[model samples]
Target: MAAPSAARSLLLCVMVTAFLHHLQLQIPPVATAAAASPNKTDGRDDGRGKTFSLTLYQHETINKTAYMVVDGVTGAGVSQTTTPFGTIYVFRDDLTVSADRASRVAGVAEGSSITTSLDGLQSLSLAKITLHGHRGHRGSVSVLGGTYNTKPSDYPVVGGTGDFAYALGYVRSSPLDLRGRTVTYKMELHLYWPPYAHYAPVPHKPV
Candidate 1:
């Protein structure tokens, strides 16, 4: 009988110790995490009507003087000529376009959703995007083209014309109406060289 009583007491003590240990484990220990923040640009007024820029770096080995077009369909085709590196666009969150418009180039289509189309553009939302590439020769490479796939972040309450421009290319066109409604836009721009070439003339004797 005494032995049984002793075993019961020992078991009770063991259970109590385990319960206390569990309670200690429930408490979280102090932790320190060192992580970098994501890159971001200053959002304007109310996360709308803000202009931003993106830079791209490129390098390619081309033997001929051909133009590459960075295509933008609705938005301005920012990259005008073949540049090794430069600013691409000044995307405005207040800008947008209609649902249906004939594509500048065939085969290339716009993104269905506003968010998807603006994916690349939003990457520049934080700040200036720097594109990198190998340095070789001028006119050796060029930006070809791109298409806009998304709508702007915000639009005027009363439908009105919104104007924007591409920073890289001087191409400008506007009078776009964003009638108080949020709509997505797609930009498709292209790169190409002139068919003709110019050369210095040499004097020759006529016979």
Candidate 2:
């Protein structure tokens, strides 16, 4: 009887050890949530008044070419020139990037606050440019549209209600003559979103 009892105890210990090993292997998948949730914005899971940060970038890549007349040219003849192209800036915002939607039914909308970073300019910079969201598509293009220019400063803040809605930034890339040289440039773009949505409770309540 004693021998049989000992054998049973050893069997139970082996089973428990196997179970512990399995649990150890399973830890990584669970820990992944703590690393970083994708598309999550700052101040998420917390109340309002939480300010986040983003990057406002602009770059110009030459694409295609067209000809135009250069000013102050001699003789009665036209001159052809290659067009230069580049984007001044671009903005992208995702409202409700991070929210405790699983806790409530009502959602929140993120809005944009016009921002600029001018001191970052060196010299001989172009005049500040502005954009109108409403004019683009009757306010359909972006939730809030306004002017922006070259500068190292905080970008605009964009948030809106509903589960999903995008107030996209405009893309401006057109050929322009700079001192007789044809050039193209695109507008800068930045995106901002806040977590303010909630999820409906399970077990629907009959109305």
Candidate 3:
């Protein structure tokens, strides 16, 4: 009886070992750390962030897109080329794909500039650039900063809405044409969105 009991216990131990081995074989292997992480090289969720650039042409003309509704202490009117200190100029400029005014209209830049310098060479500008026509580009970016009349100026991108949500960057505005009653600017936007901000890459036209 003792020998039979010993043989039964040995058989049970062998069965348990075989069952564990079979279970181990049936289970799948654990994934490696590199394989489990999201791919970062393709400008996606790699924890770095995404960047985009755009070049737009802004056209402003007196009595059309630009207006001086408020007169300064010096009594400068809309017809004047220069504004005096305390003058408020409002504009709803046309943004085009190219420098030509007849080119495809991409959007609108609506904002106001208050003359801050006595010589009217500088002003505080605030604008909301609302984009349109282009697919995958559906939003507005807010720009605000000081602008110099004679030289290129950069304004900070303070906020955004719609597809440009959580946008951050700066706009480098260079005067393309500042003749007669019309003024044109080449607006180069260097934009960025954080990793947490959802965004899709939009096809951009050549600058």
Best by TM-score: 3
Query: Per-residue lDDT of 1-207 in model 2, one digit per residue for the tens?
Result: 999999999999999999999999877674455444434544332222222222212222222122122222222222222111221322222211112213221111222221222321111122222222211211111233332222222222243222113322222212222223323222232323232122111222212
Query: TM-scores for all candidates?
Result: 0.16, 0.27, 0.69
Candidate 2 whole-model C-alpha lDDT, 0 to 1: 0.28
Tens-place lDDT per residue, model 1, 38-142, is 122222212122222211211111222122233333432322211222223322121112333321211211111121132233211111111111121111111
Off by over 4 Å in 1: 30-207
Could you list the CA RMSD of all candidates, in the order they appear?
Answer: 23.1, 18.9, 8.3
For candidate 2, report its TM-score: 0.27
* Residues 1-207 of candidate 3: C-alpha lDDT, one tens digit per residue: 999999999999999999999999887775443244232232222212455567899999998888888777753333334587888889999899999999999999999999887777778999999888454476888999888876788888899887777877677888888887788999887666764233433323223
Best by lDDT: 3
Between the candidate structures 2 and 3, which one is better when assessed by TM-score?
Answer: 3
